[model samples]
Target: MPPSPRNLDELASALLANGPVKTLPAAPKRIRVRLGGRYVADTTRAVYVWEHAYYPGYYLPLDAFAEGVLSYPGSGGGNGNGDRESGYALATLSAGGVSTDRVIVFTRRGESGSEREDGNVLAGLVRVEFAAVEAWFEEDARIDVHPKDPFKRVDVVFSARPVRVSISGTEVARSEACFHLYETGLPVRFYLPVTAVRADLLRDSAAVTACPYKGEASYYDVVVGGVDGLGEIRLRDVVWYYKNPKIECAAIAGCLCFYNEKVDIELDGKMLERPKALFS
Candidate 1:
């Protein structure tokens, strides 16, 4: 005779190394993480689990997150029971031939454990904001930031705006969406999308770079307005081409990038500063 469902705990204990009722470590009192532009995660009221697959993953209390930040990208249900958990939300970011999405798996094992003295988890919960992201595949696959890693911060910040590029009297491109970066001080580079500027404006340059996070990237020379009047400007190359990207950066492949501190950047439609160093 087979055992009844009432003996499920006994079966789990006999079949698995850990008992059926496994107690996870005390959830993290606080975890600070940098995602997108802002710190998407900063809280002490949630417990996080180490994700075993893909990049290092982090889980949070479903209620700790700001509501309405997630949506299903496909026809799948918005909330469903996971393999072990009861319910959770999932979100996706896709562009070109690449994708990097996440699932917010939730469980009601012990909601009362996260409450504060005032009988409110709301006050203890952190504020979260959702912002639209581009499917820029090259940037995501090519760069990795180590928050606790101890190396000289290679990041740089651009203080200018409305960056302008031109050759002779013809303008190539200009935009105010420039980035003011703060990072490990290696080489401050800007990975721009091909669509953000003019099309077919870059010619292949004989240069390549290697990163610990991503693979090798080739180089390109800027062809301003069909001719090279400002000389040859070479940008980093692509390491691996994702024909379809999961983020907003899909149009970045085969595009010309730049050293933020080395180039002539314009602020509010005026030339302001130049790069502090030139590696290539």
Candidate 2:
């Protein structure tokens, strides 16, 4: 027995897959993809599906076709344009439930353009339905080098800005450094080693956060830098330190954290504005 016509679900699936074949987008429903004053597929009736290389595409039915539009140039006759001979012919079809209005038929090679362009012809070639086209979703996240630095570069400038460090009511350090970034849209965290900071001034805090760009970070309290007292200098979870970042951002493995507004940042002795968030 001959094979049965593809079911609704199977037909829909194939149409979506064929939408973005090698490069072009699946035939759109509402838009006119007229190569010769003929309708191919209606985007409105089709459903978009997923695939590799390209993306999800619009799928249309086969029965609602109007007639010949595509012309297969090559399989046999020596057409002047190599590309022309290899392509197929197609036409638009009217929607009729299972046989949607978006349907179109593609002709096989070795067929005449005049013969194949009309859907009424081509009793031998296979029918591949059109599907609704869908766009691919991209991954976007913030990365901080302080979390991970697999690159192993020293002084990696993920981002640069001014930062203020205060303890006990008085500001202790203010400097401008490139806040290394691990991912993309996170804060430009500065990488300061333990030695650069005064150990006696820091107090343990239980603040922590995870970054897709970086790794994980621990928090600390500014207990003794300024002369006034502990109450005068309080940065709640403002300071962060990356424990073991990737190799590229190795310089700021165990530094401290401070908000730019609280400190005076200077680059080459000139004060600089607070750096914006890595996401911005």
Candidate 3:
């Protein structure tokens, strides 16, 4: 896998190599963000920034942020062209009379020729680290990943094609009632109902990961008999499911999907070649 973009120039190059950036209107939901027991931002108006080859990020208006929370630490220097520049800043969020350094915010100052339909400027916008925050809420329930992009599409379609998953020659799941999830810029993900999977072979795992587009996911370890002189093999956190997916991806709710790179998957009796992606 290629290393992630480290600086403004690399990020710009990556973006140019991929496609154009999109700025879209998001759903009007009350978003309350906190960090280290401090309320960082509370807003009902946030936009989704869909950058090429990257997950959508939330950008709140400057007025939405609490006062005295954002302070400029220093400049992040230029992008080598001398035209584009960036700066680093520290945010101190506070609540209940307690304060903490929430995150290091990065601000960009450049002209990318990208314009929003609403005529709002994208430059010099303050973007917070989604993971650095202690908690994030959409109205009432806490959600994982960043805010789902309203413009991004997620389709979960029922497939009649047979899908099978195996680990070391041991069948783990097979289903005709499989749901195929198609998300933008991602490989096709096959999801099987719990009834079609070998529940006995799956053990709850502590690992949890989030996708800004898919929502929060829980993992399961697959313990199966190994082949080629390897005895019992445990594939840690190989299977995952979203119990409560974001509304846009609700079609895949409660369905299980395995990491294709870590397991053998067959569709319609033909083995699938693992796709090269950010995760691979």
Each model's lDDT: 0.36, 0.40, 0.67
- The candidate that wins on lDDT is 3
lDDT of 3 by residue, 209-264 (tens): 77766778999999998565378889898899999987867878888999888888
Question: Could you tell which candidate, 1 or 2, scores higher by TM-score?
Answer: 2
* Candidate whose TM-score is highest: 3
Q: Where in model 1 is the C-alpha error above 4 Å?
A: 1-149, 153-161, 167-170, 178-180, 186-188, 213-215, 225-256, 260-262, 278-280
* Local accuracy of candidate 2 as per-residue lDDT tens digits, 1-280: 1122345334434433353233222233332222223343223332333322222333233322234432223323221111223333332222222222232233334553423342222222223333321111111222231112222223456444544454433555554544544334333445544654566656788987754334577877665434567434555655578888545555567766555544444444565555665322
Q: Which ten-residue region of model 2 has the weakest summed lDDT?
A: 132-141
lDDT tens digits, residues 1-280, model 1?
A: 1112233233222322321121122243354433443333344434322221111222344453333333355535333222222122234423333323533333222232333333221212221111123211111232222112222233324444556655444455566554433445444444443555555665665665433233345655555433455564434342122233223333334444554453454556666554454343
lDDT ranking from best to worst?
3, 2, 1
Score residue 258 of candidate 1 by CA lDDT. Answer: 58
Error of 3 at 72 (Å): 6.0
2 or 3: which has the higher TM-score? 3
Q: How much is 164 displaced in model 2, in angstroms?
A: 7.2
Q: Which whole-number lDDT from 0 to 100 does residue 238 have in model 2?
A: 56
- TM-score: which is higher, 1 or 3? 3
